[model samples]
Target: MAYTIDRHPGPDAPRLGAMVLHPIAESVPRARRWFQKFIAPYNPACSVDDCALMISELVTNAIVYGRSDDPWVVRVEWFREGASLRVEVHNPGFPASVRVRRPDANDAHGRGLLLVDSIADSWHSGPSPFGGTVVSFVMADAWPS
Candidate 1:
């Protein structure tokens, strides 16, 4: 399935921060920290710990599944839409490759997207305008009144 890459936050949504990370295992922690710090100023109502965990999982997936020899980079962007927070992880991968897997108890892998589904208020995966896959999630009412 071909997805329009223009799916992004609108004018009303303010961008918080964006980072282009190397497609490496080490980038996961960095992405989490960056997300945590950027959203800290907003005092989101959502749990920062849960957000961080989701970011970590997404970044790890990008590094593992989205890796390619040509463009070895992953982009992570965050935006604030009123009380909601939106995050996107972009990589040179296929949208079909991203799915919520049903992992067994013994499996060490295949649990990333499941965590995202359970923790995030909403999430989606599609092609990025920049020529790759983009997996995004939204935490509604993230900001406090």
Candidate 2:
């Protein structure tokens, strides 16, 4: 999907960075990369790899469940707020109805939200200003590592 990457810098820290891409499988990896670089400066406090994994899951969900036959876009953005790191994924679809559920022992799928729940300090979903579902998650600025 055609896309654009825009990075905004703040004197104290990275302000807001965003990417808009067509909802597709490849967008998942791209999202992860953008997220990693966006948070690179703060990796001393944040877990970049964990954040990237969450990005992958959210982007995958958007591509797999949030799109239709009509062309639409998925957006990713991240920024720092005090001692918190916030990430959001917005896609073209109805508001997300996300919930955490137990996965079967042998199940290979259906664990996206669960992973988010366990990893993120807090998370939620709602309608996006850009005309679709938005799922946002936040993690503490300082991780155990």
Candidate 3:
């Protein structure tokens, strides 16, 4: 598992921040803080709390479901788009499925995507260009007064 946060911003990825994290439970909060700070200056309207919660869910899923044999590297990224903020979480292993389905209340697992679906303005999961799954979500930008 690698522990590196690379900073690279570009026209294509305006206000972008990316990091490669070990697929561990602690990586979830680390990603949340990094993403919150990354989008703060650019997307002032972003709800830091919402970003925190959603980021946690995404990274948690990656850590819990990613490949175990290989060092599972989770890539987290965010960028400003038009009037929205986009966040993507990538993991090294693909899941059997990444669809949102309601789990029974008694069920202690499988609520990550459901949480993301309710919080994010829009989101989708699919094969990443690099190999594995990429879960992404967009939220409407709210500028501060």
Candidate 4:
């Protein structure tokens, strides 16, 4: 699938970046790499490793649970909000259906959201104005103050 990356900045505006990806298992790694590269300039302040891990889980959840009959694409967007970085994943799923699950120690799956909740400074899932569900998380002090 063809992917589009947008990096537009203004003098007094926040730095913004976005990408569109095919909703497939392969896209999870792609999303993680994209997020790491996009936030590289911000460096150690952002916790690139943690951010990448969270993005991986979020994208995986979108691919596995957000699937629908329609040709819906996964949209990932990030922007600097003051000293924090906010990342959002948009998919064609109901926001109410997105929840954190407590899997048993023997389970091999279903720990994605738990990782996200633990790592993100703040996170939320809600209906998107763009016509789908949006799962977003923020990393505090991601940018120099």
- Model 4 weakest 10-residue run by lDDT: 2-11
**TM-score per candidate, in order?**
0.88, 0.83, 0.85, 0.89
For model 3, name the residue pairs that clash. Answer: 45-142
TM-score for candidate 2, residues paired by index: 0.83
Lowest summed lDDT over 10 consecutive residues: which window, candidate 2? 2-11
Per-residue accuracy of model 1 over 1-145 as CA lDDT, tens digit each: 1112224456797677788888878788888887787678777788989989998999999988885669578888888887898889999998889999998999989999999999899999999887779999999988863
RMSD of each: 5.5, 3.4, 2.7, 2.2
lDDT of 1 at 31: 83
Candidate numbers sorted by lDDT from highest down: 1, 4, 3, 2
Question: Candidate 4, residues 113-145: lDDT per residue as tens digits?
Answer: 999999999999999766779999998887677
- Which residue pairs in candidate 2 collide? none
Name the lDDT of candidate 4: 0.82
**Highest lDDT: which candidate?**
1
Q: What is the C-alpha lDDT of each candidate?
A: 0.84, 0.77, 0.78, 0.82
lDDT of 3: 0.78
Q: What RMSD does model 2 have?
A: 3.4
lDDT per residue, candidate 3, 24-96, as tens digits?
A: 7878888887777766666457677887798899899888777747665889887777677788888866745
Alpha carbon deviation, residue 37, candidate 4 (Å): 1.5
